[model samples]
Structure formats: C-alpha cells, structure tokens
Target chain A: MHKHLLLGVEAIGQGAIDGGMSGVYAYPGTPSTEITEYIQENELAIERQLHSKWSANEKTAYETALGMSYAGKRTMACMKHVGLNVAADAFINSAITGVNGGFVLTVADDPSMHSSQNEQDSRYYGQFAMIPVLEPSNQQEAYDMAREGFALSEETGVPVMLRITTRLAHSRAGVEYKPVLDENQLSMPQDPRQFVLLPAIARRRYKSLLDKQASFVKLSEASKYNQYTDAADKSMGIVCCGISYNYLMENYPDEACPYPVLKISQYPLPEKQLKKMEAECDSILVLEEGYPLVEEQLKGYFAGGTPIKGRLDGTLPRDGELNPDLVAKALGKETYVGIQVPSVVANRPPALCQGCGHQDAYEAMNEVLADYGKGRVFSDIGCYTLGALPPYETINSCVDMGASITMAKGAADAGLIPAVAVIGDSTFAHSGITGLLDAVNEKSNITVVISDNESVSMTGGQDSSAYGKIESICEGLGVDPAHIHVIVPLKKNHAELVKLFREELEYEGVSVIIPRRECIQRASRRKRNISRHANH
Target chain B: MKSNIILAGVGGQGILSIAAALGTAALENNLYLKQAETHGMSQRGGAVVSHMRISDKPIASDLIQMGTADLILSVEPMESLRYLPFLSAKGYLVTNTTPFVNIPNYPEYEKVMEEIHKLPRFIAIDADRIAKEAGNARASNMVMLGAASPFIDIDFAKLEDGIREVFARKGEQIVEINLKAIRAGRQFSEENK
Candidate 1:
C-alpha cells in the first residue's frame, strides 16, 4: 500500500529494502541525502542493524559496500552523481575485479543545477565502466528495479548502476505492490584474487566482461520493467525513459496519444523495442530526463530521413530536467504559459532555520573572535554554513563537505590568525575526522567549532556518528583534552559559549569547541512523542 | 476526469501542502496521481510551485507545459499572474487578493494589487483576512487551499484529512486552529457563491 509523494532519494532506499538488500553504504549530499536518512529512520532496518552508516565520504562508502559484497552479501552503495567523481578510481577497478556478491550503485542526478555544482549525469559513468544501468519511472518501479539490478549484477558478475533524476528521486505515485525476494547470503571471499587487481588478471576479466555484453542486451529485452504499449492510433510513437514517461503520459490523454508508447526503465538500449517503435510510427519523440542517451542510440538506428526530435536539436530543453508541459509541447500541444504574477515574490535565499543551534554557535564565535579578521572562519556544508548568510555572516569559506576543517588548516599554515572551522556533528563524521587528524599531525593552529546538533537536521535528521562521541573523537585524534571544550548551545548560555569560543580562538595549537544541543525540530518532535506515549 | 494543476506562491506559503492535499484527494478518489516540487533554498521567499496531475489511469511526469494547466491556484495574486502562462485556454485562475511585495523593484505594493485586479479570468479571495478570521494569521495557505478545492475534482474531506494528519503531531490546539482555518476557507468560498 503506497501513499504520499515519497521523495526520489527516499524511494531509492525503500527500493533497496523492498528488494531484499543486506546492507547500504552512503555519504550524504543534497538531492541524494535522503536514501541513507530513510534507512536510519526505518525501524525494521535499524533493528536489523541493516549496515547503514554515513561513511567518511563517497570513497569510504564505496569501499564499505565493496567489503559487504566481498562477504557474499547484496549491498547497495549510493551517492549524488558528483560523489561518483570522488569514488571513480575504486569504482572503475571494481568493474574489472568483479564482485563476490551482488552490488548495486544508485546515483541521484540533479539537473537544472538544483542543489548541485554541475548537473552531470551518472549514466555516463555507467557507460564508461561498461555496466548495465537501470532508471525507474516511479517509486514502485524504483523498488522493483532495485531488486532486478542486484540480480543482474550477480548474473553478470558486475556492479549495476541505477541512475535517477531529481523528479524521479522526490515524486510519489502509487506503485503496484510486490513481494521481497531474498538473496543468497554466502560467506566471505576465500580467494584473494577476487579483490586483488593484478594487471594480468584484470585484463582477462575486462575481455570477459566485453564477451558478456550480448547477454546483457538480451537481458534488457526480457526485463519486466521495460514495456511497449500500443496506442489507439499507431501513426506516431513516443519513447520515454525514467521520469520523462510520467510527463509524457500525464499530458497526452489516451485519445490524444494514439501513437504507440515505449516505456523504458532498464538500459543497454533494447534494440528490438526501438526498432519496433520506429517501424510503427511516422515520427518519434525521444523523452528522457537528463541526457540524450536514448536519443543518440535511436539516431544511429534512424539512418534514413525519419526525423527524431529531443535534446540534440533542442526540441526539448538542452539542459534542466524535462516536465510534462515540455513533453506536451513536443507532442504539439499548445503549451500553456501562465501569466507572470506581480513581483510580490521576493528573493529570500535560504538562511539557517530560526533558533538553529548553529546560529547560536556562530554568533558566539563571531563575538568571541572580534579581533580576528572577517575571513578567518571556514565552514563546511550543512546548516552551519548558513553562517555565510546575513546577520550571522561568521563563516567565510564553504567549498564543499568537510572542506572547512582542512581549509582552516591550510589557511592557518599560510599565516592567518585564528583560522577557525565551523562544521556540524554530522559533517564531522561525514568527512571532517580525517581533516581534524591532519590538523593535529601538522600541529596547525586551527580551531574547529564542531556544531553538534545531535543529528543531521539539514538533510532531514539522520543520526550523526559524532552525536555522542565528538569530544572523544577529538581527543582520539591527538588534540589536547584540555583544549576540547563542550558548551551548551543556547542564547541564555551565550556568555559561557562565547568564553569557550574565545579560548579556542586564542589557542596556539589545535583546539576544538563542541557546542552541543538537539535540533529544535527534533526536540519538539521528541516532546510530542513523549507526551503521546505518556497519554497511551 | 483528468486534470493538471499548477500551484504557485512564495516560499513558506504552503504551496507544497496544497499539492499534497490534492494528491491525498486523488488517493481518496482512487485516481492516479503524480506531483513534483521545487524544494530547498527556493522555498525561502523565492518563487515556489508544485505540478500535480490527476487521472483515472496511471500518470507519468510531474512537469506540465505552458498553456496546459487545467487549474492555476495562486496563493498570492502576483504568483498567480506570474504562472498564468501555464493555464490552459479554458482554465480558471484563483488567487489571493492580498499583495505580498517583498521584491526589490516592486517597492510600491499597491501597484501589484492594481495589476492583479485587472485580470479577466481571475477570482480573488482575501485569504489572509480569512486566515486571520479563522483565528490564526498563518493559515492563509490553508485558506487558499480551501478556495482552490471547490474548482477541482479534489475531495474536501481528503484535504481536511491531510491538514489534520500534518498538524496533528503539533498538538490538539494547532490541529484545532488549522481545522478552523480550513472551515473558514470553505465557508468564505461558499458565501461568495
């Protein structure tokens, strides 16, 4: 029973669980953050210790999932599309070494530069690595296809890629329910060569992978996810993949869309279906979310002058995710352009949530280090970096996740005074630990303000590894125990918090100030839950 | 019946909630629903919109093209006019009378109100006043949702159910206030009728 518009990232996680996954490994990034968060919140998953944790980064998560597969378990490794750029070295070789068990890599792509640096599609990565890719249309298909992806990985002895766009990642519609099919759980790999990528052996495996391509194409043909529906009018046809199928179907009523429609959710470009749609229709509209993967393949098939329209000729938007209206326009619907409403909608960019602990922590830091130059604060991603916004404008640099601590270390080494890095509890575990260790080892005079909110509240409240252990982790990384200060984050505690922040700002060696508090939203939820439980 | 709706407003206006309400209605009616939202920073006073498609059969994408929206639900008059290009030729426009001028160029708030009053197909409701009358000023979004409900195939009971489900966790007082807001909205539209 499916209800609600379950976000795409959440769907991916549910898909994995419904597909009978043994483990999931991930490092959070916007647009792809919800997958791991969903697993953390799922009671059944947490009770099972379903092997969900925010690894140090994409690389660590990729390796962890690899380890799970090495132990003959079905594991899913997920990350934002750019995160694959970080884990590429390992990901590329994993294809050659192959897997001891099923491994699925699910990457969420952000088109239109929504919550991402670049809208680079992960399907290209799959193509480069010569792996089969699956892109599901909706939540149900996402769940069903996730199961198939793992099985396909096992069948081909290769890692599979499941690429989803922003719309597919976040939208929700009813999906026909399916039963979970369990996987074969074997023991750890007995042979060392299963992981060791000796050049000689890898070359042979690469050749064998090429030999398996024909079967992969055949598998695509037989995939239950891909379907061809005959339109009442077989004069024209539309080829839609992933979320684009939703747009195409939503706009064209059954009477309006008499052309045959091919819905593709699995990859390797089913040649037979493409040929059939081409032969049946007078012209074709290629509908896909991110790139021209299908359009390019279909172009090759159309050596004759049957015009194929899509992103290549700018029939659809050359960039950004496609929507139903765009597909309607392509299908010759008089595209509705709503009148421009008056400019009452002001440009209010996101700041940290009101009364956020990070704001209190940053405000105190700013007051404590008034003598330090404005550019001294380096912040990582998360709500803490919202300090770069007005009123609190405490942090100066926020390049990426975990960049704050390391960037502060670099700036301090370059002779900046009071180079303080503000990072969240979740971000510290995600990527700041190594940077902290590096600062200690180098004896850099960088102060790290670990804004411990007890949860990854920015990405919808996943538990952070540093929640209860920030102080211990700082000490374990060789920071002086005396320099590790824990302050309660609140306006009433502003003076004491500022005192600790000042002490850290002035310290000559590596110092850490952990401002700890539960997120207001979480605190409120807990209160309500506790009250409700008491009533029961 | 098949319908596509475009719900537009500023961030924090509960455009998302309205979309969710319609989807809940679709579910209650056993209709296929597909909806997409623009989330994150764009929600901070920036323009926000949700595309919703409801049909008897399976629905595809969340994106709708220009001139194809079956209904345009505008929480603010300006946001309604801004998204008018998406309204189908025969589609109706329901907008709030209040003008929230936070834009840099539109310093004179009355200018926007004047422009919105001129649109022929526009049906304006003072949702802000209705929300206030309902006992909470913040329920303006709910008032707008109520105004749009009557124009579409969505069930009022489902919208009420969604409002209750969303606010129930906040406590009984909040749930009660929101219920009143929805009632006020429904009553406001019905009285005008």
Candidate 2:
C-alpha cells in the first residue's frame, strides 16, 4: 500500500476513489474545496476515469451527484459545512426519495468561524435527514470509512453523510492505500414510485426509511470502524468518536488509563459498543466533537443511563471544539504540561506575497479608488481580499464566496458611489455568477473586478473553474461588451488598468473588469508538471 | 506524555512542511500523532499555523487550546509571538529573530526584538539569515527545527530522514538542500548547547 500526506477534503476524494466511485461534484470553498481538486490532480484518479469538476454552486453540485446516483453510479457530493444550508433542499429530499445507487455527502464543518460566517455543525443535518453519519478519526479511517460508506449506503438504500471538520479537512495525515475496488455494474432504479415524491409514494418511501433503520443500526453496530478497547477500568469509561478519540489518548498518553475506551468512528450510536463500555465503567464520557448527540443517545440506553459525561456535563465545552488539553481536563488528569521551550521572538501579521498578481490588482484598484476612501471596496475570498489591509486598503467587505457582486449591488442601490466588487475567477464561478446575473437583471450600477488568476491559489494551486472562459461568462451574462474591460494587470499596464477601472466605476450599468494573469504559485506548479511529463 | 505544539509561519514558507516532518518523526518513534492545520484564510502569503500533538496513545481533537501549547516553533519572530497565548507557562519558544514584516506595520525592528526579549523562556536566532548563509533562505523552517530538536522526544536523524522523504518526491536538488539545511540546523543547535 502507498501513503499520502492527504488533506481532509482530499481524503474524501481518496475515499471516493477507494470506494469505486464514478463521479465527484463540488463548488470550491474552504475545507471542502480540496476534495474535487485532489481528484483532478491525482494521476491514478484521472486514469480511473473519475468525474471531478467544480459546479456553479452547492445546489448544482448536489444535483449533479444525485443525477450520477440515479444512473446506478456511485457518487460523492462535497461542500463546506455552511454550503449544506444552500443544498439542504436536495439533501433532505434525497433521504426521503431513497437511493438506487450508492451515494455519500461529504460536508466539512468549520468551527470558530475559520474561513466561514458561522460554525454550524452538519451532523445535525444528517440526524434531521435520518441518514447514517460516519466520521473518521484519522486519514486511514477516513479512507476506510469512505470505502465502506458506499457499501453501507447500498445496503440500506439511503444516502450517507460523512461529516469532516476543519481539522480533518485541512490537516494532513498518513493514509495507507489498498488495491482499488472494482466498480459495481448495477442497474438504475426503474420503479417510478421509488423516486417520485408524490404524497402517496413519499409516505411509502418514508415508511421504508423507518423500516430500514433497524438494519442500518445493526450494520452500524457490526461496522469494523466502531471498536472497543477493554482498557476497562470500571472507574471511568470514555467513549470517543472521530478525532476525539485521538485527543482522549493524547490527553492520557503515558498510561493505558485504568478504564474502558470505546472508539466510535461510525454513526447511529453503536449501541453494542456503548453497552459494552457501560457494563465495564461507572461513568462514560461522550467525547465527540460538535454536539452531545452521542451523549444524548447513551443517556437513553441506561435504566437511568449510567451517569454520562461530555459537553452536557461540562466535561467538554458546550461549543467550539475539543483538543488534548480539554480531554485531559475531562479525565481529571494532571495538566499535560506540553513543552516548556521559550520563544526568542515576536509577533507578525500576514501580508501579500511578493510578485503576486493579486498585489498588482489591489494596487491598481486602490490607485483608482483612492478618492472613494476606505470601506467602499467590496471583495470576495481570494488572495486579492488581503487588500483590506493597510497600504492598499482596497476591499472592505469579504462575507463569503461570490458576495462581492451582491454586496456591491446592495451598496450601490443604497447610493454608495463607485460601488466596487472584486472577486477571483474561481470564486466567480463558485457563487459570483448569480450575483453578476442579479446585477445585470436589475441594471444595478456596480463595478466588478474578476481577478482571473487561472487557478485557485488559496487552498493550494487548483485549477479555476473559469480557467479559460472568464470573458465568455461575462459576455453571456449580458455585461455590456464596451463596459467590460480586459487587462493583464502588470506594473507596466498599471495606468491603463487604473484608467479602465475608473471608467467602469463611473458606468451606470454593471461593468466587469477581467484582470487576467496566472498565479505565480500556479505557474511554478505547471512548470513542475511539464518537467514530470517530460521525464516520463 | 501528552505534548501539544503550535507551529506558525507565513504561508508558502513551508509551515506545513515542518509540521509534517515533526509528525513523521514522532510517528516513527512509536508515538500516536495528530497534526492538525488550518488551510483557511491564509491565502498564499497569509499567516498559517499547524497544531501537532504527540503522545504514546490516541488523541481526540487536533486543536491546541489557548495558552496550552508546550512548544511554539515559529519560522518568523512575529508569527511566534502571535501564537504566544497558545504556549503554556514556561513553554519553550524557538523562533528566528529575523524580522519578517507581514502587515505593513511600522514598528521598528529593534523595538519588535526588544518586546520579544521581554517574554519568558525565549530562544531567538536569525534563522533566516542562517538559512541564507547555508545557501537556501527558504530553509528558515529547518533552522527553527534545529532550535526545537533538543526539546522534543524524536531524534534529529529521524527528522532529517522525514525531511529527506518529503523533498525527495519533489526533486534531487530540493532533497539535497533540505538535508543540508536540516543538518546545518542540527549542528547549529549543538554548537549553542
């Protein structure tokens, strides 16, 4: 088996490949963007004929995966934890309609507002949909769970939710590989009543969903991923799920802890494993990230439920996330006094990279918008958004993907002069297109600068969805051809770019400025790829 | 046994590279390792941090609580100070003294250095200068790794091997430079000791 320093979202892609999946669909976002990007990068995945591409939005991505599933092909849909809120319609109904082919929804949750507006847990969504949710503790389990998750979905005829967190999605871990599984040549569901959500058929499918719960629970109990280690100390039994198990062991590393430890990596609350832990220990600690759902489930298992501890009992924090120090506190262990080395240095804030196209774009935009003062520039997520800092101070708002256009439209409608929206090419495709369409349809006066960097340089260098079609997208969206200006943002063209930028700002209708340049980092990656190909 | 480390630096400065090498070394030493990172917001040149916990058993969360990190491996002095709250009292801090002005802050270099000198348990080196002298300025992370080697349980040679494994896949030139850089760091730490 080979190993990889796979990121969390990349693990989902790896999982999909291992599970014999045919297609992977997603729109780029933090924590979830890497899934499709990885598949595109991996040679093995391409040779396997994996269908991995960025969709227009979460809804489009979800529907694409569903369509693939309907064709009797295994599929995986991925998005950020918050993006699920946008795709919830299809997500909820997919469970109600049941599944003909194996399918998995991989959502990467971000707690602490890390590149997100909020830290909402996606696990609750799975519970609401009444689908089995499986979370892996490490990259190995992440891969294994993905492989098994498909089978579980097939066995139950229900779509599965594999929820990952920022840590898992962004972190790299050593993942062992196995021989790729062969694809199943299965037939699509021909029974029209199975998918038709007419009330009569919907009621039958809902009953079938409930009827399958017992077997699903049984399968979860027998899942190889849910394990129990009889480090049984009747004094205290700890049941940890996903990455929490890693923390529990990290908190008490020196000793085996005179207690039983139940490691739950699968969902539906492995009752068999919980019962075994409860039988051995006096108090059980539910060490799962996000919610106390497992704790609540454990409470129902006991006659009065053997006193359970977790977020509810304040053993773990009610909100945010859990780490080693918190786990140590939960176990009542002496402080895990980490290394006591001292720093011989100071603190520094972040800045733009030298020779970055974003730097030039920000500078040109700032030069043109200097008269507008600060807080007038609306921006989306990308390297260019760093313009919000001093020196340039070009962008003011950065809410999420593709918010610049909508935000600029709103501000311009409110009479904010020279309303400017700056977004990257990848982000424009991710969610900015609709905002642009809204601006065009409403004839909102806004100037949008689409920084076409040829690649998504933020989460490593991945191909941008609008790699070669920025101009066409703008033209197709009814942007005035004369108002739409294209310029290669360089120091030499600074004056021209700034001039065009000003003209677009002065335009009454929606104007698009396409700042085209290859991201320097992506240029290096392409060089590496060419050299590799030459050597081969 | 449970030791949490917070390693911070600018993006593209090999922040993840250091964490990966450290994690591999710990894993090789039979320690259970969970190295978590944030790939969010740190678009290219933005600040980046990786949380690594090494223990003899499994771990739950990969996050390092505020003011609880045992070791802070900072490639840049300012980035190190940014993560000071994550460090435990008397926690070891190893960072390069070379000033890397990320934000357009006008604080004088000497003033920043003076402020860092006020902190507890600090070891400052001109890691960037040293790495540059060693012929690869990008090897500043290895210089910090040199300062951090003695405190952790993993062997220096193990870290050297991990570094080799990482860069080998990139190219022979990178492999050679990284190995030499790691050795230079190890030797520099030894000289100070």
TM-score of chain B of each: 0.88, 0.89
Give, for candidate 2 chain A, the lowest lDDT window spanning 10 residues.
A338-347
Per-residue C-alpha lDDT of model 1 across residues B1-193, encoded as one tens digit per residue: 7888888887756777677666766787888887777765455456778878788876655666677787888887667767767787778778888866545443455666676566655567898888888888888888887877777776788778878777776677777877788777777667763
Candidate 2 C-alpha lDDT tens digits along A388-454 = 7766777788887788999999998999877989999888988898899999999998988898888
**Tens-digit per-residue lDDT, A19-82, candidate 1:** 7678888877767777887887887677667888777678889988998898898899988888
Best-fitting candidate, scored by lDDT: 2
Error of 2 at A377 (Å): 4.3
Residue A91, model 1, lDDT: 94
The fraction of correct interface contacts reproduced by each prediction comes to 0.62, 0.44
Taking all chains together, each candidate's TM-score versus the true structure is 0.84, 0.85
The CA lDDT at A67 in model 1 is: 86
State the lDDT at B179 in candidate 1: 79
DockQ of 1: 0.44
lDDT for residue B41 in candidate 2, whole number 0-100: 69
